[model samples]
Target chain A: MTPSAEDAAAGLQYSRVLDAPPELVFDCFTQPGHLTHFWAPKGASAPTTEILVDLRPGGRFETLIVNDATGATYATRSVFLEVHAPDILAWHEEHTGMTVRVTFTALPGGRTLFSLHQSDIPDQVLRPENRAGFATTLDKLSNYLHHLADGAKQ
Target chain B: MESMLKNRPPGSLDAAFAALADPTRRAILTILADGDATVSDLAAPFAMSLPAVSKHLKVLEASGLISRTRNAQFRPCHLERAALDGVGDWIEDHRRVWDERLDKLDQHLAELQGGKEERDDS
Candidate 1:
């Protein structure tokens, strides 16, 4: 479904200091080759899936995460509305979707401050604790990305 | 958010998640989980008054994390462990989902590394 990625949803911040430079860290996020390393964790078999990305303003992006074992897929596709190099990349994930704004600012000693701030969703309904789940999921992503940067050096 | 999770054990998932989300609620649950407690017993740890404790209890009760029972004029609050099974179940599912993603990443990285080494050798 085409969900609108709006900024109005309560925002979330997930930050980590990647061992790589800002450009390198940014590349992994924007490039498919690098994305497959840190986007989602390992073990999900989505062999019947495709990922596409055009890292530019007004670019189209699409990806399908399918689990063949379970015959499930969470397909999300959107357009890249803006890109500010290694500093920022903004895109509309899918209405009722998530708009992710990832920022990479250089840190001292060649490290990069990686932050993925996503916003746009109404109150936490049903199971209200999803608010905390968001934080944990982001934390996992931060660690996953951190290890990716570390592994690159070894 | 986790609210999307359906087909979970009764009030179990919601109780655990909602309880941990707030410090006051978490402390309250922890107190009850250790043993059944009266309203005054629940109120002792907090700086807040009985009414505040009542409000927190209302939230917990609505979530089915705790049950308030009558004993003479005093109502004792008791923990419902069955209502918290969702916590463990939800967490495990979440773990499995992420673990799957991580596995794919490992394979992708190895392939990238292999390709790079071949290029370097050439």
Candidate 2:
């Protein structure tokens, strides 16, 4: 599924083309076996025991990541908002009030372009005025912070 | 396993989100990010009246995004670094998590497909 203009403005977006088929890439996200192999960040591990995926709308998709060095765990609980195999997977994270949408598109040479977009839904859904300038504001803030850091270094 | 990371207080985050919703308030933040500015200084760029600018400042101030100095007559608003950092950090942290996970997924896919090809040959 494509992100709307408002969603694009207020959301965090990331996309990367992987050297695999869309079906395989989608399975890596939905299947516990594939997810257990790479669900957590580097240095953190998501055990199959803790990785749960009920791949239907309104179903649960949860994971627990344990930091290898710190032994710290981060758990996420989300409900699937949309689940269309090999194409789209969207979920609403309960704790953060953020909805994450992931799309996988087939490329020319057996590759898949995986894109993820996350946005805070509650405020954006309630108020329309807040949507347009969010991403631009963030870009300005990020640049400003970088400038401050650069000045400090010099 | 114990959950190590605690979620940020939803109230403050909610306020920040709400405060950032308006284009005017966001423009105010952009102005303050470069340097602190008074209501008059902020309002000049937008052609907005002082009261309207003050209203946006109030929302920003309440959200802890900007603080106004009490000593000066104009009460210049200073951007609160912590609040801005909080919002940036939240997004960055999630982005980092997905980035790393996707990197691993790339490697896993190669291995999975390699094993399948080997099996087909055998």
Candidate 3:
């Protein structure tokens, strides 16, 4: 076991193993051309524009993602917190109030496994209907927890 | 209720983040998650005054993370789970986007490696 784990506190995580080595994967993340090619959402036809990457502590990364349907552009601006080449890249986005930490692990077959963890995501991304569903689910969970507490007391 | 929605902070997510930044406020939310509570009930657990808890409640209300009932007597504060849940959903959206982008990265890398192998053989 390579001790692959995502911090529960982060609240968001995704891990995938790539066929390339860690170094190569790191370059793909850092390079503007590579990011322009892959950073857009699946099925998104608009090429990513206004890419900026300053790979250092306190450095900034800015990108624009255009929605095909509405032709709306969304901007993501973040300051790098940690940048360990070929191993980790972490950043905190002020506008979104979220911190994203990505870790690159080296596998035996020259493959790389990286996990992306995001903490404190902002509410702007959620649609109203989805938010309503979450509220109902939360109420259910609250009731369940309350019952558990009562059982413990008994 | 519609007025309350209108009164919600302009940048809803920004307000939500600011409201949840404090540990005390987060604890308040956890308690309310159990069930709605009055200001005094929320205050009793903390070593703080009713006014402090009330202030925190106001912040939560403004963030649309909690709602207070109109009843003047209890004015029970209920958890607005949607705001918190919305944060989770936001993260999930980004995770999905990353998954797609990373998959593309994998394919790009395979192409690069294949090119290198062909060059070496030739």
Candidate 4:
């Protein structure tokens, strides 16, 4: 029952330029071997994992990640809404009722500018005290973007 | 600040989401955002009956989105912006999660590409 307005207000976005070409970057997502190596967050590793990808509109994709420390397992189930090879990927994650879209822009010199957008965030994140922490995160992101831009200039 | 929310009763988040889901309820929150108003003032804006508006207000109040107070005969409802702001924070948390994951992903991609190059050279 997350308010639709909140979803609109809270959509997340980030973009970065990666060293690899678009096709290689795209393959990193579609291929299970590459995905399993990098899909987990910073602290966790995907071990004893199962990944199934159908790679078409309305096709299903799922990943099961196990926490190394606690042995707790988390599963992410999503259905593809759109898939354009080496360019765009969009899916609806069933667990959080969120839609994620990622775009790969091919650049000169085998580099790719990758952009990500996610919307319809779930409700649990709204705990009252987390408000300040949220502001700090945005600051961090702003700094990251500025740093990236500065590096691009240099 | 952590203890501030910890002190609040549980399920406030669920109630807030449920209450805000309705368009009428959201509009009511918007109207109240201007300033506190009596039940009748809020009911006048909508085509629905006063009772219906009251029902929406009741839900909002239960969700901690608004607080009602009585002064003799006037029961004015005040907007609780704090509750809605919590949602904005939650969204920030969502963005951070992806940021952290992508950082890891950046490293992984570097390793994958590096390994491929080494294999090709050999």
TM-score each candidate: 0.51, 0.63, 0.56, 0.57
lDDT string, candidate 4, B14-117, tens digits: 45644555667767877886799988999998988989888888878977778889565778999876666664454445556667766676777778677544
Q: Write the per-residue lDDT of candidate 3 for residues A45-150, one digit (tens) a residue.
A: 3254588889998999887777777778878788888899999998888777777778899998787878765555445554467555343465544443333232
Model 4, residue B75: C-alpha shift (Å) = 15
RMSD of 1: 10.5
Interface RMSD of 1: 11.2
| lDDT at residue B3 of model 2 (Cα atoms) | 13
Candidate 3 ranges with C-alpha deviation above 4 Å: A1-8, A45-49, A123-154, B1-88, B115-122
lDDT of 1 by residue, B19-45 (tens): 334447656876775688888888887
Give the candidate number with the greatest lDDT.
2
Top candidate (TM-score): 2
lDDT of 4 by residue, A11-117 (tens): 45567777788998888888788887778775566642488889999999888877778878889999998899999998889988767878999998677888875
State the lDDT at A39 in candidate 2: 89
lDDT tens digits, residue span B3-121, model 2: 11122233254456545655677778888878998888999999989998888888788767889898998899998766676656555566678878887987798798885442221
Docking class of 4: incorrect
Which parts of model 4 have CA positions greater than 4 angstroms off? A1-10, A123-154, B1-85, B115-122
Alpha-carbon RMSD of each model: 10.5, 10.3, 10.8, 11.2
Error of 3 at A153 (Å): 30
The CA lDDT at A31 in model 2 is 87
